[model samples]
Target chain A: MSEFTRGFRAGIPIGIGYLSVSFTFGIMAVSYGFSWWQAVIISMLTLTSAGQLAGISVMVHPGQYLEMLFSQLTINIRYSFMSVSLSQKVAASFSGMKRWLLGFFMTDEIFAVASAEKTVDAKFFFGLSVAPYFGWALGTLGGSVLGNILPEVLMNSLCLAIYGMFLAIIAPKARTSRAVLCVTVVAILLHVMFVYLPILNRVSSGIAVSVCAIVAALIGAWLFPHDEEENEA
Target chain B: MREFFIYLVILVGSTYLVRALPFALMRKKIKNRFIRSFLYYIPYTVLAAMTFPAAVLATGNMLAASLGLIAGGVLALQGKGLTLVAFVCCALSLMTDLIMITLN
Candidate 1:
């Protein structure tokens, strides 16, 4: 099989994972007065979940544009770092525009699988993105169109599936690497600290999360430097 | 909905900008040792930060959510695959949430 096909096959689970969460997002949009089309468009244009949710909150309350900008930017800035790492792995021949297209689909789940590779082919990246992108868009369409129809229990249960996916992704790495475990602990501690701090808690959650993650990562870099071999190994 | 529509443009534009910046600027591979190490760990820390605290709200109540988080962690710790771990936690959290609701 071609590398693209391999990547596409691997992406099936991620697409399903995104469907569950973005389905919730679609439901959320309608409840907040957005039309089904708007919700679908949102998913199509911007695939980031936390950022979409934050922006929807702004829509619900009609917050300042700057607040929306700051919140979404901070929530999604992790992608910048992810893309930076991915840029190295992508084929050296890819142009700036191609790299930008790859950046568009670097959601958390996709990044987890993609970055684990020693080298990334452009075709492979496109294959990986297509299914998840479709799943996200289609799920949003389903949810917004079917909003308020499902029983409460199932929605509640499925809502956590995405978080479960997140745990599944990180837990393995944490188990294998001491440095990873340390970084995870530090980030969690910092997040908890921010959540409890009254003034800080009111700040954009994206910013808070961004700060905590960056700090934890910085500490990890300084305290537990690894050789290049360890990276690929 | 004009506000919503307008913000859609802003949100999508800004979010895309944030995501695309590093990819555009860092065309070459990172050679800086500390920076490379730092980028390597970014995913781990970021994912961890997003999962916790928030995961505790999964089941409609703190008790069930907490239980679900612990159960998910344990399952994941055992080196289970993604699908199995997620489904187990979803089921566990749903049951805990129902039990809590009926009792109250």
Candidate 2:
């Protein structure tokens, strides 16, 4: 397949997933009394799920800016890490314009799709990123405009779809490799700790969860020796 | 009105900062093995941590979470797809809720 086609094909699942999840986010922002444009703009500008959730908290509790900032910083700090990982994949020939444009769409789904592909260049990743970019903006716009026309139960059910997508992405990897499984287990344990522990409960969730997950995953990877062949690029 | 703009500025600027800054700074490729491996697995690890608590807790009630957990775990272990696992668990939970409601 051509680079463009590969990118779009890779990006297709992400686009579909964005449509579903961003719809929920749109409904949420509107329900919280944001204008339709505001809902649309938020989804466009900030593509991260947890980041958007944190933003909602900030919108509701403006005085808690510091808390929200910490949470958002925590949740999104991983993106920098992903960007560094992707630096090798993106072409050296890419123009400054392309770099800036591509930077706008460094989402989890986009990252997954782009990074997983074999021999895809920057153009391909950029191509895949485009559809989700619009899908999110439009999905949020539709949700904001539609504004709870559906039954509450149905809407609640739709919310689970995002989690479903997440599971689908990780489960396939976990099924194949013990390394992924170890990472998944470590992450879950760390999450449970913060959720259950009283002392940790005071910490801002974004930071606490991010730190614990990263630390745990790093330690797990260090202890579990994966076969060398699997690690090669 | 000013507060609204401030919030807007923060939202836009922060989003741009997180997304845009790295690509600009890391002009060359990252050939480092350790950081690359760390980046490769970070999303899955982060996502597991993020999603598991909510999926397990299933919204504050242990009974509901346990029921959902059984449905999800069984279906997942059986090699059903994720949509099936999540929806089936949720549907089962909803049915349980309805049954109790009707019985009462």
What is every candidate's C-alpha DockQ against the true complex, given to 2 decimals? 0.59, 0.40
Sorted into a CAPRI-style docking class, model 2 comes out as acceptable
**Candidate 2 Cα misplacement greater than 4 A, ranges:** A1-10, A30-35, A116-123, A145-147, A221-233, B1-8, B27-41, B56-104
Per residue, candidate 1 scores C-alpha lDDT tens digits across A73-186 of 656766776777677777776657777777788887788788788788878888999899999999899888887787677567666666776687788888989998999999
Best by TM-score: 1
Candidate 1 Cα outliers beyond 4 Å, as residue runs: A1-7, A28-34, A57-61, A112-119, A226-233
- Docking band of candidate 1: medium
lDDT of 2: 0.66
Cα displacement (Å) at residue B57, model 2 = 4.8
Local distance difference test scores for all models? 0.78, 0.66
Q: Please name the candidate that would achieve the greatest lDDT relative to the true structure.
A: 1
Q: Which 10-residue span in candidate 1 chain A carries the lowest summed lDDT?
A: A224-233
Pairs of residues at least 3 apart in sequence or in different chains that clash in candidate 1: none
lDDT, candidate 2, at A3? 80
lDDT of 2 by residue, A1-233 (tens): 77877777767766766776677678777767788888887887777775785577467755555555655665676677666556656666754667677777887667766667554476787779877888888888887787668655445444444455556557767877778788888888887888788997776566666776677667655765333423211
